[model samples]
Target chain A: MKQMRRRRVRRALEEQCFLWLMRLSLLGAVGVLGMIVGVICWRGAGALSWEMVSSLPEGGFYLGREGGILNALVGSLYLACGATVLALCLAVPVVFYLHTYASPGGRLRHGVRLALDILWGIPSIVYGAFGFAWMVYLGVRASLLAGILTLALVVLPILARTLDEVVEMTPVLLRESTLALGATRLEWMGVLLRQSLPGLLTAILLAFGRGIGDAASVLFTAGYTDNLPDSLLRPVASLPLAVFFLLGTPFPEVQARAYAAALILTIIVLGVSVSAHLSLARLGRYVIR
Target chain B: MGGVVEQPDKGSQRSESFRLSGRRRWSDRVAHRLLGLIAGALCLLVVGVAAALLLRSLPLLSTFSLFELWGGQVWQPMRGLFGYAPFVVGSLWVTAVAMAVAVVPAVFSGIYLAEYVSERGRALLKPLLDLLVGIPSVVYGVWGVLFVVPLVRDWIGPWAEQTVGDALPFLGRTSPSGYGLLSAGLVLGIMVFPLIVAVTEEVMRSVPREMREALLSLGATRWETTKCSVRRVGLPGILAAVVLGFSRAFGETLAVMMTVGNVAQFPSTIFDPVYPLPALIANNYGEMMSVPLYEAALMHAALLLLGVVIIFNVGARLVIERLVRRIR
Candidate 1:
């Protein structure tokens, strides 16, 4: 009886230790996020200015002399918007094909999903390299269009897969009723599209967030310029690349600007994420579970 | 058929409706074919990317043997000697270190969220995890440079050197600067932490409730029930999560590049600087285009990175699919 009581005490002690360890670990993880945001905000706030968001970079921007990252800001928006639209075009059809045309238990559906998963895993840098190779073969130069194309490839799988999950969650009875009403597959897809509108919007926002912040894939394809892009063929600056290039300079001012650029990019991403989350909850009321 | 039979009195209306239905069917067939074609093209794009990388890298392959490229230690672009040993080793060391530092804590945190937290707590924490995951890699790199590097240089490095330097030579500081494998690993570990936690939490949640109930009803403690029932059932899924995290950490370029002192060398210790494969490609691609075979060599590095990541991702996905099948 004494031995059993001792064993029970030891077990209780062990449980307490493990539970505390878990709490500490979680605190550490959350602490890391707080630190990242704190550092960026603390460093970036000083460099951010009204003019910085409005004007173009001067001749000596890299030397920390003068200029704002407006060029990069606009360029990033253009690139991300273009890529999101392009990816949406392809991703929507693919998701529709999976749900409407392909049999639920078919190998084709599985194969497509597997392909998308692998594509999603491929690094942004690899996509950049492949895009660069293709541009060279096609006799095209680094430009906004090139970046858009490469970034489209990067976000396609993400858009498709997220939308796929949303579509998968949709009630099957809705589809059966639509088809039973003498509607064709295309007509049924229309209903699915409406039902999954919020999810589709969320997917687009997520993909846009990814596209805007990605530096690796656009490093080679979207050659940075000081001026806003006038044509699809002209080079354009991006916020991620702007941060990357600015931070590399030996000048303290430039590094500060880099921080400011990072802050802006982070804000844009966080905004998109928050909106996506909110919209999902808000618009999801109309969606049949 | 019943509608048509009932509308037999209205013959002209029935015929008009039949024609309309025929046209609708034709359009549906056309749309189906079009969408199917697009999906098929997406698959072709994957194949196209792999083929393009292989073809672009062929020039380097023809010029140098695979053995020379992989086994040689020196990397001199001007001298025309391309050795990938240092980069390969560097990537492995950083990724290994990242996994080591992150796995246990992340798994623990995931379990805490999944099995221990209230529903309200889980809902609040899961979005925070998503936010962490959404932060760009460049921001992580900047954070590393500003925060983690200094912390390592002033504190961790000195403490490590004093306690374990003599006992474990690899733990010793080979370079005074804190930019090296450890810094990169710490930053990358943080970046990948949320991913592992999210995946692990998901996998743990998927473990059936009955298992936990059965174990708990037997008078087991909550911790004991989790360890015996939840972990046992979720082991394969947790493994898949780890592999997915590994693949993500391996291919990350910008953050790793900024923190990992881009010196192309085989690291003798954790503090020694090294260059990784993705960094090798990112840092050199545009500037070194004038050098002979430089582009091809970079392409080869990209190909290598892609191949390894794809293999790992495919394996993890298969494991996940099998687990899902078993659970269902």
Candidate 2:
């Protein structure tokens, strides 16, 4: 009886110890996130100004003598938008086919999912390398078009898989009813599209967020230029690369601008993510669960 | 006789409907073919990426034996000597260190969220974790350069050297600049933390409630039940999560490049500077065209990175699939 009581005490102590350890680990994990945002905001707010967001860089921008990062701001918007549209065009059809035409739990469907998962895992750097190789073969220059194409490839799997998950969640009874009502496969796809509209929006926003924030895939394909992007053929600057290049310079002023650029990119990503989360909840009212 | 009669009646009714909705039937068939074609094209694109990398890398392979490339240490593109040992080792060191720093804490945090937190807490915390995951890798890189590198240079490195230098010789040599494996690994650990946590929590939550209830009825403590029931059942899935995180860290470029110091050498200590494969490709692409076989060498690096990541990703996916099947 004495030994059993001691054993009980030991067990209780062990439980408490582990529970505290887990709590501390949780705190540490959240603290890192807090620190990242805190540091960026503290440094970036000081350097941010109306001129920084509104004006383009001048002759001595890299030297920290003049101008703003309007070129990168607009360039990132254009690249991300273009890539999102391209990826959507490809992703939608593939998703529709997987749900409608392919048999449920069949090898083809599984293989496609597996393929997409692998694609999603391929690093942005490899996509950039592959883009560079293709451009060389096609004798194409590093430009906005090249960047969009490569970024599209990078986000395609993400868009597809996210949309796939949402579509997969759709009730099978709905499909059966639609088919039983003498609807063709194409018509059923229309219903699926309408039902998954919120999911589609979420996927687009997520892909755009990923595309705009990516630096590596665009490093080689989208050659950075100081000027605002005027044509698809022209090289374009991006906010992430802006941070990279500016931070590498010797001038403190330049590094400060890098922080500001990073701040802008972070805000954009944060907004996209929050909206993606919020929109799902808000629009999910119409969804059949 | 009744089944045969019903089958003929159904076939005639289907034919009649098809004849009545002829245009709709045509449109459906056309759409199906078109969508299937797109899906097929997507599959082809995946294969194309791998093939293109392999073909582009062939030139370098033709010039150097696989053994020479893998084992060589000199990496002077200007001098026409290509060696991958340093970069390979550098990647290994950074990834290994990052996994070490991240896995335990992340798993603990994940378990805390899954088993200990209230529903409201989980709801609030999950989106925050998602936000962390969405933060750009470049931002993480900048954070590393500004905060982590300085912290390491000033405090962690010197403190470790003084305290543990005699006991472990590896801790004796500190990189003066603080831009080395340890800084990169720490930064990467933070970067991959949310990912591992999200996955692990998901895996743990997938464990059946009945199992927990049964254990609790037998007089097990909450922690004891979790250890025996949830952890054991979710072990393979947690492993898959870790592998996924490993693959992610291995292929990350700009962030690792920024903090890793980009020195092409086999690091003797955690503080020593090192170069990784993705960094090699990203940094040298601009100048690669000027040197013979330089572009091919970089392509080979990309191919190597892609090949390894694919293997890991496929393995993890298969494991998760098997686990799901077993659970069902």
Candidate 3:
């Protein structure tokens, strides 16, 4: 009895230690996140100005010039919008086919998803390099068109996979009930689309967030310029690139501007993420578990 | 006879509906074919990326043998010495350090969230983790350069140098500049922490309630049950999460590029500046076009990065798939 009591005490002590370790780990993750956002906000708030959001970047911008990152802000929107549209055009059909045409766990669907997973995992720099190589081969200079295409390639797998997840989560019964109504496969797709509308929108917003913030994939492909892009063939500026270029220089004011750019970028991303989460939660209620 | 009659009646009713919806049927067929074609194109795009990488890399391969490219320690691209060892080694060191630092916190947090946290707490914490993942790599890069580098340079470097530097030769002589493998690795650990947590949490949750109950019924504490049964069952997935995190760290470009002082040297110490493959390509590909075989050399590096990521991803997929099957 004495030995058993001792053993119980030892086990209890071990359990308490384990519990503390787990809590500390949780706190660490939360702490890192709080630090990143809090620091960005603190630093970026000091640098935020009306001119920073309104005017074009002037000459010697990297040398701490007079104007702002407006050009980059607009250009990022253009690039992300174009790429999101392109990705949606390609990704939706594939996701639809995966659910409607291909049987679950079929070899063809599996192969396609596996290929996408591999593509998804390929680093953004590789995409940039691939874009550069393709541009060189085709004799096309760095332009908005090239960046959009590259970003589309990058976002396709992400969007498709996200959409596929939602579609897969769609209760199998929904598909059957719609078919029971003598709905054609196309009509069934419409029902699935309606059912997964919130998810699809969330996916688009997420991809847009990704494309807008990505500096590496678009570095060489989207060749930055001080002016906003006037045509698809013209180069474009992006927020991430602005941050990179500004922070790269030795000037302190310019580095502050980089923080401002990061702030704007972070806000856009966080806004989108939070919205996506909220919508997913809200619409998720309607989805059959 | 009754079944045959019913089948014909059912067939007639279907034919009547089909006749009524002839135009809709044609459009549906068209939509199906169009979607199928798009799917085919999307799949082909992945092939296109691989093919383009190969074609671009071929020129470099034909000019420089693999021995001259990846075989040596020297990496002076300007002088045409394109040895890949330094960058490869740099990537290895950074990834190793990142995995070492991140794995414990990440794995424990994932387990805690899955097993220890209340539902309300899980709901709140999960999104916070998602927010971490959603933050762009560039932002991480900026943060690394602004905060992490300075911290390493000023405090961590000095502290480690005085305390552990003498005992471990691998720590290498500390540099006050702080732009080295250690700084980059620490930032990368922060960047990849969320990924590891998310994946490991999913894997842990899939461990099934019955297994936990069995351990609990045997008078095991929650910690003991988790450690012995749930964690043991989730080990493959945990490994997979770590591997996935490693691949992400290896391929990370902007954050690492900004923090890791871009130098073409084999690092003997964590404080030594080194160039990674992605950083090398990003920093030099533009100017490289002016030099003979320089562009090709950079392309080779790109090819190498691509190949490594693909291999890691494939391995992750296999391991995760096996884990899923085992659990199911």
- Ten contiguous residues minimizing lDDT sum, candidate 2 chain A: A102-111
Q: What share of the true interface contacts does candidate 3 keep?
A: 0.75
Tens digits of per-residue lDDT for model 3, B280-312: 888886687788778777778888888888888
Candidate 1 lDDT over B1-328, as tens digits, reads 5544453565664656544477788989999889888888888887899999999989999999999998889988888999999999999989988999899999999999998999999878887888888899999999999998898899989998999999999999877789999999999999889988988888888878888898889999999988985556789888888999999999999999999999988888998888999999999977767988888888999999999999999998888778877876
Q: lDDT tens string, model 2, A7-61?
A: 8998899889999999999889878989999998888888998889999999898
Q: In candidate 3, how many Å is residue A205 off?
A: 1.3
Candidate 3: give the clashing pairs: none
Number of backbone collisions per candidate, in order?
0, 0, 0
List, for all models, the DockQ compared with the true complex. Answer: 0.78, 0.80, 0.75
lDDT of 2 by residue, B8-65 (tens): 5546656564553778888988898898788878877878999999999899999899
**lDDT scores in order:** 0.91, 0.91, 0.87
DockQ of 2: 0.80
Candidate 2 docking band:
medium
TM-scores for the candidates? 0.96, 0.97, 0.96
Error of 2 at B221 (Å): 1.2
lDDT for A7 (candidate 2): 89
